[model samples]
Target: MKIAASLIATLALAATTIAAPDNKHGNKPNKPIVINKKVLQTSKVPFIPHSGTALFTNWVGLNVDFKYVKPVFDLVNATKAYGNGTLISRGEAHITTIPPTEYDNILHPAGVTIEELNALAAKNNRLQRARFGLECLGRVQVVTKDGVFQQSVQIILKNYKDILSYRNDVFKLFVKKGGNPALFAADNFTPHITIGFKNRDIFIEDGVYKGKNACIHPIVAK
Candidate 1:
């Protein structure tokens, strides 16, 4: 009798797992409670791109030429922040725009989609599933073009990955211990960078997102 009960419980667990999203690989109905991985994220998110690629998220033409760029650069140069006289600030961050051929009309740039994400999981032999939520301003205004927009750029922060900060808001929402990417089951803190020419999505005063994303200033060289 006990053996029969154990078998029944196992079958029930297997059924539940099979109902979840199917993995990319061709696996026979996976067993239940199959998700056993964590999400990875980090704190101190990286900065935005330099002037060269900053236009990736902006529309065709917009007005976003920041005049203070030179002065700020001067201040950094005048300071002894660079002991070796090397300009490392430029290497801090970058935002490269994918060609339209990748993902044409999507609101945001080409990132790992649900399909690709699933495939990655299979390739890495991941069965447990989790999600992280983050966003990038879809468009921005260009100072030069007057009324152009830039494409949105957002990265999908997933589970079983390493995170910089284990205590972000999204991680708190789903993860318990903290935002440490190493212990993530599912997280939502998406470290993102957006390029906008004249986007109002950013909060100039408060210095945060007017809606769902944070403000990113791309300090590029002329």
Candidate 2:
């Protein structure tokens, strides 16, 4: 009886060991790796508040495919408090090709409307079926209409040669059509998608609020 009991116990132990979940085989989903790092402000241009109507009346950009950014959205959701910002909707995510600052110089002065620009972009051979890769995360500060500064988190993009080329082509076309080139000349175009914005003023350089408050660090997920 003792021998039989010992064999049965051994069999039960083996069964339990075999049934145990193994993380190495990916039986469980891997948790996102979150890192807190000090990142410099990449752009000198002020962040435009899309919620406001007066400043951002019209802008040109290429819509980003959600599949390539879903993981980023997931990461945003996972680390919302760390970012302390509002999440941008999936449908609204895009890479800004031509900012509103150039509207007066390129679009309006050139007699090219937003609808017309869209049509042109649709027919462009290079832009057709083109996609950009996500490079990294960046943060910037935007001066609001009230002169208050707020922090914004953005996703920097890579593999944007086609987009850059298209932008230059548009600029040249506008300039040729008697549009003012002053604003375009001074404009520093950085192709990125703003993912979220924090309401409170956060110093982007040191990631602190007004240099006295605690720092709300930007979360990087991998």
Summing lDDT over every window of 10 consecutive residues in candidate 1, give the lowest-scoring window: 33-42
Query: Which lDDT tens digits does candidate 2 get at residues 12-34?
Result: 45534432323353222244334
Deviation of model 1 at 85, angstroms: 34
Q: What is the TM-score of each predicted model, taking all chains together?
A: 0.18, 0.55
**On a 0 to 1 TM-score scale, where does candidate 2 land against the true structure?**
0.55
Candidate 1 global TM-score: 0.18
lDDT of each: 0.26, 0.49
